[model samples]
Target: MEVAIDNSEFSYLPAQAEALGVPLPPVERLTLPLADGRTLSALRFGSEAPRVTLLHGAGLNAHTWDTTALALQQPLLAIDLAGHGDSSWRDDVDYTPRTLARDVAAAVEAWTTQPQLMVGQSLGGLTGAALAASRPDLVSEVIVIDITPGIDVTAGPAALREFYAGPTDFASRDELVDKAISLGFGGTRPETERGVFLNTRMRADGRVEWKHHFAHLAAQALAAHDPGSATAPSVLHETGWDDLAAVTAPITLVRAARGFVSEADAADFQRRVPTARLVVLDATHNVQETAPVALAGLIESATPARRI
Candidate 1:
């Protein structure tokens, strides 16, 4: 089947940069072959060796960090975690942070020349912690946005779960945009449209479907069983805390005021890593999307001089 996938993923960079009042830099998509014949994909934001490496949350692609990358204006790589974006889905569906960290480590080694300031959100945050623990040489500093090992599984917005529980394929991209807007997801109509365009593809069957594997898997699960009984794959596990504890890099925990991490969770994080810095932002769970400039500022401050 001939599926028509939009290859011009970077076409919207100019507008994104313009909106942020930043100069658009050279952006390119890079793919690396994994050991199992699967591939990892990422967006290289500048021509220089990347100083930072970003990982997006569950159900999001690398482009989710586009605005944040623009605002930062530094050499960076935004990776498409396995089973999301252009990265190959795993046959085993083992998306635990420890498992995902292995692939992220591979991308970092291939795409970056030196240790990078690792920034990750939600699921990506956990993965970053795991990577820092397992491969300290690749991550010099780590920033975890709006997530911790203690996050409540049921704390996520119900609307988000409902959105994924809907049909996997839609009649048009606009339909998905409309659905997201109604569910109180994306920021604005134009922003939602752009996000939809980047995150979905046209199937050979003439329908539009999400590029991430989790959404499709959730929809399939819901179709086979009662909606109340079926849910998305769990990203949380007990070992996440051990990974956080084992990290050797400098740690900064950014908690979204209105997001999932609670005061208790933040307290627990501080207790676990007494030397870690913590900051709270007034935004939702998806801080990269909701608070890109502010998030970028944090990344900028923490970023050190580029290493040769």
Candidate 2:
């Protein structure tokens, strides 16, 4: 599928330049066509060639990287993977990493023919691994944020599963924001509120619902599959290891000291992929939210110099 850069729905506004004391560059909303006839939406932070591309975790969107992007203040593109943000939802409920990687690879190819640094968090990390392995021509480096192929997937994602398993619609936006804060989705009150606002939209029915399709799609897939069956993301873990092994690019695994990726997992990753570099910080799973400046520094270090 080809990517078409459109400016109809969103445009770069100078007022959005400063965030969290970081001077953000201009941003533009863009869209690309997916192979399955769905559209992938994204935000471009600079007009310069997209030196870096960011993919958020499951259920989140491009806005999740707002603070990190602002801190980076470099030419980067943040994508709303399929079934998230303003992107088109899939009728088949195929949110597997391989499927998502094809869409991302297409967008990268459209954005630039040269190899660019790729960053992903959780689900996005799995997708980035798949892309780096499959389309080495498009990705020069891979940064997996607080997630790895050998992550403890059994009980670690309980919070995420519980959050998405609940009702999708909210009586009011404030209600949703309150719920996110209570769930510890963000570090501070204002951050939680902004996260809720970014992830939701007003429906024609005058009700507020999450813009991401993970909850609804997961429900559908769960109902159709047998009880005790692995969810769609099981393939992510199954194939992610292989993807990491196949990647030719220099890889960096940013592990949160207090997060799901354990020291044992990090050791195993190093053993499996010798080129992988591990960096640990004192934080939780959502390191981008709690440690944007540090995360930005990691990204800058992994990124290659800009092409003239």
- Against the true structure, whose TM-score is highest? 1
Per-model TM-score versus the true fold? 0.94, 0.86
lDDT, candidate 1, 16-98, per-residue tens: 88888888988888889999999888889888999899999888899989889899989999999998888888888888899
lDDT of 2 at 112: 66
Error of 2 at 37 (Å): 2.1
**Clashing residue pairs in candidate 2 (N, C-alpha, C atoms within 3 angstroms):** none
Give the runs in model 1 whose Cα sits over 4 Å from its true position: 1-5, 153-155, 226-231, 305-308
Off by over 4 Å in 2: 1-20, 152-162, 218-235, 304-308
Each prediction's whole-model lDDT (CA): 0.86, 0.76
81 in model 1: Cα distance from truth in Å?
0.3
Clashes of 1: 0
- The lDDT, on a scale of 0 to 1, for candidate 1 is 0.86
Q: How high is the lDDT of residue 167 in model 2? A: 67
